[model samples]
Target: MAVKLATAMALFAVGITTGCQGMSEQATNADSKLDLAVSQALAEKDFRLYYTTGRRPVVPGFEQLAFKELEAQCGVKAMPGTGDTLRSEADKKARSEAYQYAREFNIKMYEACLNRR
Candidate 1:
Protein backbone atom coordinates (compact mmCIF):
# COMPACT_ATOMS: atom_id res chain seq x y z
CA MET A 1 0.00 0.00 0.00
CA ALA A 2 2.86 2.39 0.82
CA VAL A 3 4.58 1.75 -2.53
CA LYS A 4 1.32 2.31 -4.43
CA LEU A 5 0.68 5.63 -2.69
CA ALA A 6 4.20 6.89 -3.43
CA THR A 7 3.90 5.91 -7.10
CA ALA A 8 0.60 7.79 -7.42
CA MET A 9 2.09 10.88 -5.83
CA ALA A 10 5.08 10.78 -8.16
CA LEU A 11 2.82 10.47 -11.20
CA PHE A 12 0.70 13.39 -10.05
CA ALA A 13 3.77 15.58 -9.68
CA VAL A 14 4.96 14.69 -13.17
CA GLY A 15 1.55 15.49 -14.61
CA ILE A 16 1.52 18.85 -12.91
CA THR A 17 4.94 19.68 -14.30
CA THR A 18 3.89 18.71 -17.80
CA GLY A 19 0.72 20.79 -17.53
CA CYS A 20 2.71 23.83 -16.46
CA GLN A 21 5.09 23.41 -19.38
CA GLY A 22 2.21 23.17 -21.79
CA MET A 23 0.66 26.34 -20.43
CA SER A 24 3.96 28.16 -20.82
CA GLU A 25 4.21 27.04 -24.42
CA GLN A 26 0.68 28.25 -25.10
CA ALA A 27 1.41 31.66 -23.67
CA THR A 28 4.54 31.97 -25.76
CA ASN A 29 2.61 31.12 -28.90
CA ALA A 30 -0.04 33.69 -28.07
CA ASP A 31 2.59 36.35 -27.60
CA SER A 32 4.27 35.51 -30.89
CA LYS A 33 0.97 35.68 -32.74
CA LEU A 34 0.14 39.03 -31.22
CA ASP A 35 3.51 40.40 -32.19
CA LEU A 36 3.15 39.25 -35.76
CA ALA A 37 -0.27 40.83 -36.03
CA VAL A 38 1.06 44.11 -34.73
CA SER A 39 4.03 44.06 -37.08
CA GLN A 40 1.84 43.40 -40.06
CA ALA A 41 -0.50 46.21 -39.07
CA LEU A 42 2.37 48.65 -38.78
CA ALA A 43 3.76 47.66 -42.16
CA GLU A 44 0.36 47.98 -43.80
CA LYS A 45 -0.18 51.42 -42.33
CA ASP A 46 3.17 52.58 -43.69
CA PHE A 47 2.40 51.11 -47.07
CA ARG A 48 -0.95 52.86 -47.24
CA LEU A 49 0.56 56.18 -46.26
CA TYR A 50 3.24 55.88 -48.88
CA TYR A 51 0.84 54.85 -51.59
CA THR A 52 -1.54 57.72 -51.03
CA THR A 53 1.03 60.45 -50.38
CA GLY A 54 3.90 59.27 -52.59
CA ARG A 55 6.19 59.57 -49.58
CA ARG A 56 7.47 57.33 -46.87
CA PRO A 57 5.56 57.31 -43.61
CA VAL A 58 8.72 58.08 -41.69
CA VAL A 59 11.61 60.39 -42.41
CA PRO A 60 13.64 59.52 -45.52
CA GLY A 61 16.71 58.11 -43.84
CA PHE A 62 14.69 56.13 -41.31
CA GLU A 63 12.11 54.46 -43.53
CA GLN A 64 12.03 51.43 -41.31
CA LEU A 65 12.13 53.20 -37.98
CA ALA A 66 8.70 51.96 -36.97
CA PHE A 67 9.73 48.39 -37.69
CA LYS A 68 12.80 48.79 -35.53
CA GLU A 69 10.65 50.17 -32.77
CA LEU A 70 8.38 47.13 -33.06
CA GLU A 71 11.36 44.82 -32.79
CA ALA A 72 12.58 46.64 -29.74
CA GLN A 73 9.18 46.34 -28.09
CA CYS A 74 8.11 42.82 -29.08
CA GLY A 75 11.15 41.02 -30.51
CA VAL A 76 9.37 40.41 -33.85
CA LYS A 77 11.33 41.01 -37.02
CA ALA A 78 9.71 43.20 -39.69
CA MET A 79 8.42 41.46 -42.75
CA PRO A 80 10.49 42.05 -45.88
CA GLY A 81 9.19 43.57 -49.15
CA THR A 82 6.38 45.44 -47.53
CA GLY A 83 5.17 48.13 -50.01
CA ASP A 84 8.02 47.49 -52.42
CA THR A 85 5.85 46.19 -55.21
CA LEU A 86 3.30 48.95 -54.92
CA ARG A 87 5.79 51.62 -55.89
CA SER A 88 6.15 50.72 -59.57
CA GLU A 89 2.51 50.01 -60.37
CA ALA A 90 1.35 52.37 -63.12
CA ASP A 91 -2.40 52.32 -62.65
CA LYS A 92 -3.73 54.93 -60.26
CA LYS A 93 -6.91 52.97 -59.50
CA ALA A 94 -4.89 49.92 -58.61
CA ARG A 95 -2.82 51.98 -56.28
CA SER A 96 -5.94 53.44 -54.72
CA GLU A 97 -7.44 49.98 -54.23
CA ALA A 98 -4.27 48.72 -52.64
CA TYR A 99 -4.27 51.66 -50.29
CA GLN A 100 -7.86 51.01 -49.32
CA TYR A 101 -7.18 47.36 -48.74
CA ALA A 102 -4.24 48.14 -46.54
CA ARG A 103 -6.34 50.56 -44.53
CA GLU A 104 -9.09 48.00 -43.95
CA PHE A 105 -6.66 45.19 -43.21
CA ASN A 106 -4.80 47.31 -40.71
CA ILE A 107 -8.03 48.04 -38.92
CA LYS A 108 -8.82 44.33 -38.62
CA MET A 109 -5.35 43.54 -37.38
CA TYR A 110 -5.58 46.34 -34.85
CA GLU A 111 -8.82 44.92 -33.55
CA ALA A 112 -7.31 41.47 -33.33
CA CYS A 113 -4.36 42.80 -31.39
CA LEU A 114 -6.65 44.56 -28.97
CA ASN A 115 -8.72 41.41 -28.46
CA ARG A 116 -5.60 39.40 -27.78
CA ARG A 117 -4.53 41.87 -25.16
Candidate 2:
Protein backbone atom coordinates (compact mmCIF):
# COMPACT_ATOMS: atom_id res chain seq x y z
CA MET A 1 0.00 0.00 0.00
CA ALA A 2 2.81 2.41 0.82
CA VAL A 3 4.56 1.59 -2.42
CA LYS A 4 1.40 2.25 -4.41
CA LEU A 5 0.80 5.52 -2.64
CA ALA A 6 4.37 6.58 -3.27
CA THR A 7 4.04 5.74 -6.96
CA ALA A 8 0.83 7.72 -7.26
CA MET A 9 2.41 10.67 -5.52
CA ALA A 10 5.35 10.59 -7.91
CA LEU A 11 3.11 10.53 -10.93
CA PHE A 12 1.05 13.37 -9.56
CA ALA A 13 4.13 15.44 -8.95
CA VAL A 14 5.17 14.95 -12.55
CA GLY A 15 1.73 15.81 -13.83
CA ILE A 16 1.69 18.99 -11.81
CA THR A 17 4.84 20.21 -13.49
CA THR A 18 3.59 19.36 -16.96
CA GLY A 19 0.17 20.82 -16.30
CA CYS A 20 1.62 24.16 -15.24
CA GLN A 21 3.76 24.47 -18.36
CA GLY A 22 0.76 24.43 -20.68
CA MET A 23 -1.66 26.09 -18.36
CA SER A 24 -3.61 27.99 -21.00
CA GLU A 25 -4.02 25.08 -23.38
CA GLN A 26 -4.95 22.67 -20.63
CA ALA A 27 -7.42 25.06 -19.10
CA THR A 28 -9.29 25.41 -22.37
CA ASN A 29 -9.08 21.77 -23.39
CA ALA A 30 -9.54 19.99 -20.10
CA ASP A 31 -11.86 22.01 -17.92
CA SER A 32 -14.09 19.12 -16.99
CA LYS A 33 -11.16 16.79 -16.61
CA LEU A 34 -9.54 19.39 -14.37
CA ASP A 35 -12.64 19.50 -12.22
CA LEU A 36 -12.65 15.76 -11.81
CA ALA A 37 -8.95 15.73 -11.08
CA VAL A 38 -9.42 18.30 -8.34
CA SER A 39 -12.26 16.26 -6.84
CA GLN A 40 -10.33 13.00 -6.75
CA ALA A 41 -7.13 14.66 -5.60
CA LEU A 42 -8.90 16.19 -2.63
CA ALA A 43 -10.72 12.94 -1.88
CA GLU A 44 -7.43 11.03 -2.07
CA LYS A 45 -5.46 13.68 -0.15
CA ASP A 46 -3.11 14.45 -3.02
CA PHE A 47 -1.82 18.00 -2.52
CA ARG A 48 0.84 18.21 -5.20
CA LEU A 49 -1.16 20.88 -6.97
CA TYR A 50 -0.64 23.20 -4.07
CA TYR A 51 3.07 22.57 -4.21
CA THR A 52 3.25 23.30 -7.93
CA THR A 53 0.93 26.28 -8.02
CA GLY A 54 1.74 27.88 -4.70
CA ARG A 55 -1.95 27.98 -3.98
CA ARG A 56 -4.05 26.92 -1.05
CA PRO A 57 -5.59 23.74 -2.42
CA VAL A 58 -8.29 22.98 0.08
CA VAL A 59 -11.38 25.00 0.87
CA PRO A 60 -11.52 26.91 4.11
CA GLY A 61 -13.00 24.93 6.99
CA PHE A 62 -12.79 21.72 5.01
CA GLU A 63 -11.39 19.68 7.89
CA GLN A 64 -13.92 20.94 10.34
CA LEU A 65 -16.74 20.20 7.89
CA ALA A 66 -15.47 16.70 7.31
CA PHE A 67 -15.10 16.09 11.01
CA LYS A 68 -18.66 17.14 11.67
CA GLU A 69 -20.19 15.22 8.77
CA LEU A 70 -18.21 12.05 9.35
CA GLU A 71 -18.92 12.10 13.04
CA ALA A 72 -22.61 12.29 12.28
CA GLN A 73 -22.39 9.36 9.90
CA CYS A 74 -19.78 7.18 11.59
CA GLY A 75 -20.47 8.12 15.18
CA VAL A 76 -16.80 8.95 15.57
CA LYS A 77 -14.40 11.69 14.59
CA ALA A 78 -12.22 11.01 11.57
CA MET A 79 -9.36 13.10 12.84
CA PRO A 80 -6.32 11.11 13.91
CA GLY A 81 -2.80 11.85 15.15
CA THR A 82 -1.56 12.38 18.68
CA GLY A 83 -1.85 16.15 18.08
CA ASP A 84 1.80 16.20 19.11
CA THR A 85 0.95 19.31 21.06
CA LEU A 86 4.09 19.12 23.05
CA ARG A 87 6.18 19.73 19.94
CA SER A 88 8.64 17.27 21.34
CA GLU A 89 9.67 13.96 19.81
CA ALA A 90 11.07 11.76 22.56
CA ASP A 91 11.60 8.83 20.20
CA LYS A 92 12.24 9.25 16.50
CA LYS A 93 11.09 5.74 15.56
CA ALA A 94 7.89 6.02 17.54
CA ARG A 95 7.11 9.41 16.04
CA SER A 96 7.68 8.05 12.56
CA GLU A 97 5.32 5.15 13.22
CA ALA A 98 2.68 7.48 14.56
CA TYR A 99 2.92 9.66 11.45
CA GLN A 100 2.52 6.64 9.18
CA TYR A 101 -0.50 5.44 11.10
CA ALA A 102 -2.04 8.89 10.96
CA ARG A 103 -1.54 9.03 7.20
CA GLU A 104 -3.33 5.70 6.79
CA PHE A 105 -6.23 6.90 8.88
CA ASN A 106 -6.46 10.06 6.76
CA ILE A 107 -6.66 8.05 3.56
CA LYS A 108 -9.32 5.80 5.00
CA MET A 109 -11.41 8.75 6.09
CA TYR A 110 -10.99 10.42 2.71
CA GLU A 111 -12.30 7.34 0.94
CA ALA A 112 -15.21 7.07 3.32
CA CYS A 113 -16.16 10.69 2.74
CA LEU A 114 -15.92 10.27 -1.03
CA ASN A 115 -18.19 7.25 -0.87
CA ARG A 116 -20.66 9.15 1.23
CA ARG A 117 -20.72 11.92 -1.34
Candidate 3:
Protein backbone atom coordinates (compact mmCIF):
# COMPACT_ATOMS: atom_id res chain seq x y z
CA MET A 1 0.00 0.00 0.00
CA ALA A 2 3.01 2.29 0.45
CA VAL A 3 3.63 2.33 -3.29
CA LYS A 4 -0.01 3.20 -3.96
CA LEU A 5 0.06 5.97 -1.35
CA ALA A 6 3.19 7.49 -2.87
CA THR A 7 1.65 7.43 -6.35
CA ALA A 8 -1.52 9.07 -5.07
CA MET A 9 0.47 11.80 -3.33
CA ALA A 10 2.44 12.46 -6.50
CA LEU A 11 -0.74 12.71 -8.51
CA PHE A 12 -2.21 15.08 -5.97
CA ALA A 13 0.87 17.31 -6.17
CA VAL A 14 0.72 17.38 -9.95
CA GLY A 15 -2.94 18.25 -9.89
CA ILE A 16 -2.40 21.09 -7.45
CA THR A 17 0.41 22.55 -9.54
CA THR A 18 -1.60 22.36 -12.73
CA GLY A 19 -4.63 23.91 -11.10
CA CYS A 20 -2.53 26.77 -9.71
CA GLN A 21 -1.08 27.53 -13.13
CA GLY A 22 -4.53 27.72 -14.67
CA MET A 23 -5.69 29.99 -11.88
CA SER A 24 -2.71 32.29 -12.39
CA GLU A 25 -3.33 32.58 -16.10
CA GLN A 26 -7.00 33.32 -15.54
CA ALA A 27 -6.02 35.99 -13.03
CA THR A 28 -3.73 37.68 -15.54
CA ASN A 29 -6.47 37.79 -18.14
CA ALA A 30 -8.99 39.02 -15.60
CA ASP A 31 -6.70 41.86 -14.54
CA SER A 32 -6.13 43.07 -18.08
CA LYS A 33 -9.83 42.98 -18.82
CA LEU A 34 -10.57 44.77 -15.56
CA ASP A 35 -8.02 47.56 -16.13
CA LEU A 36 -9.26 48.22 -19.62
CA ALA A 37 -12.82 48.19 -18.34
CA VAL A 38 -12.13 50.69 -15.56
CA SER A 39 -10.34 53.06 -17.91
CA GLN A 40 -13.15 52.92 -20.46
CA ALA A 41 -15.80 53.33 -17.81
CA LEU A 42 -14.06 56.40 -16.45
CA ALA A 43 -13.89 58.05 -19.83
CA GLU A 44 -17.49 57.62 -20.95
CA LYS A 45 -20.58 59.05 -19.23
CA ASP A 46 -23.76 57.52 -20.58
CA PHE A 47 -22.77 53.87 -21.02
CA ARG A 48 -26.29 53.11 -22.11
CA LEU A 49 -25.48 54.61 -25.50
CA TYR A 50 -22.09 53.13 -26.24
CA TYR A 51 -21.16 49.87 -28.01
CA THR A 52 -24.52 48.14 -28.15
CA THR A 53 -26.46 51.32 -28.63
CA GLY A 54 -23.61 53.15 -30.39
CA ARG A 55 -24.54 56.57 -28.93
CA ARG A 56 -28.27 55.78 -28.99
CA PRO A 57 -29.93 56.89 -25.79
CA VAL A 58 -31.79 54.51 -23.48
CA VAL A 59 -32.52 53.96 -19.83
CA PRO A 60 -29.65 52.63 -17.77
CA GLY A 61 -29.77 49.33 -15.94
CA PHE A 62 -30.87 49.07 -12.33
CA GLU A 63 -27.36 48.64 -10.97
CA GLN A 64 -26.04 51.38 -13.20
CA LEU A 65 -27.48 54.06 -10.99
CA ALA A 66 -25.32 52.95 -8.08
CA PHE A 67 -22.31 52.83 -10.35
CA LYS A 68 -23.23 56.21 -11.75
CA GLU A 69 -23.07 57.64 -8.28
CA LEU A 70 -19.80 55.87 -7.67
CA GLU A 71 -18.46 57.31 -10.89
CA ALA A 72 -19.55 60.78 -9.89
CA GLN A 73 -17.77 60.40 -6.59
CA CYS A 74 -14.69 59.26 -8.49
CA GLY A 75 -15.51 61.64 -11.35
CA VAL A 76 -15.77 58.76 -13.82
CA LYS A 77 -18.44 57.70 -16.30
CA ALA A 78 -19.35 54.54 -18.20
CA MET A 79 -20.11 54.35 -21.88
CA PRO A 80 -23.86 53.89 -22.18
CA GLY A 81 -24.43 50.40 -23.58
CA THR A 82 -24.65 46.70 -22.89
CA GLY A 83 -23.85 43.50 -24.72
CA ASP A 84 -26.05 40.43 -25.21
CA THR A 85 -24.46 38.85 -22.18
CA LEU A 86 -22.41 40.21 -19.31
CA ARG A 87 -19.68 37.55 -19.30
CA SER A 88 -18.67 37.59 -22.94
CA GLU A 89 -18.59 41.03 -24.55
CA ALA A 90 -15.01 41.21 -25.79
CA ASP A 91 -15.51 38.45 -28.35
CA LYS A 92 -16.08 41.06 -31.06
CA LYS A 93 -14.40 44.41 -31.60
CA ALA A 94 -17.73 46.15 -31.69
CA ARG A 95 -18.71 44.21 -28.60
CA SER A 96 -15.50 44.91 -26.74
CA GLU A 97 -17.02 48.09 -25.44
CA ALA A 98 -19.84 46.03 -24.07
CA TYR A 99 -17.43 43.60 -22.45
CA GLN A 100 -15.64 46.42 -20.70
CA TYR A 101 -18.94 47.68 -19.39
CA ALA A 102 -19.76 44.19 -18.20
CA ARG A 103 -16.70 44.32 -16.02
CA GLU A 104 -18.41 46.99 -13.99
CA PHE A 105 -20.98 44.40 -13.10
CA ASN A 106 -18.17 42.11 -12.09
CA ILE A 107 -16.46 44.82 -10.09
CA LYS A 108 -19.60 45.78 -8.26
CA MET A 109 -20.59 42.20 -7.59
CA TYR A 110 -17.30 40.37 -7.01
CA GLU A 111 -14.53 42.89 -6.34
CA ALA A 112 -16.55 44.76 -3.77
CA CYS A 113 -16.44 41.71 -1.54
CA LEU A 114 -12.66 41.82 -1.51
CA ASN A 115 -12.45 45.41 -0.32
CA ARG A 116 -13.56 44.67 3.22
CA ARG A 117 -10.83 46.96 4.52
Instruction: State candidate 2's TM-score.
Output: 0.27
Q: Give the TM-score of candidate 1.
A: 0.38
**Quality of model 1 by C-alpha lDDT:** 0.49
The CA lDDT at 79 in model 1 is 26
Q: What lDDT does model 3 reach?
A: 0.49
State the lDDT of candidate 2 residue by residue for 28-94, as single tens digits.
5555654565567566654421100112222122334544454445333322233334345664455
Residue-wise lDDT of candidate 3 within 1-117, one digit each (tens)? 999999999999999999999999977887787667545644553222221333332223333445444443332334443434444434465455445545454455333323423
* Candidate 1 residue-wise lDDT at 3: 100
Go through the candidates in order and give the clash count of each.
0, 0, 8
Show where candidate 3 strays beyond 4 Å: 45-117
**lDDT, residue 74, model 2:** 35
Report lDDT per candidate: 0.49, 0.47, 0.49
Q: What is the alpha-carbon RMSD of candidate 3 to the true structure?
A: 8.7
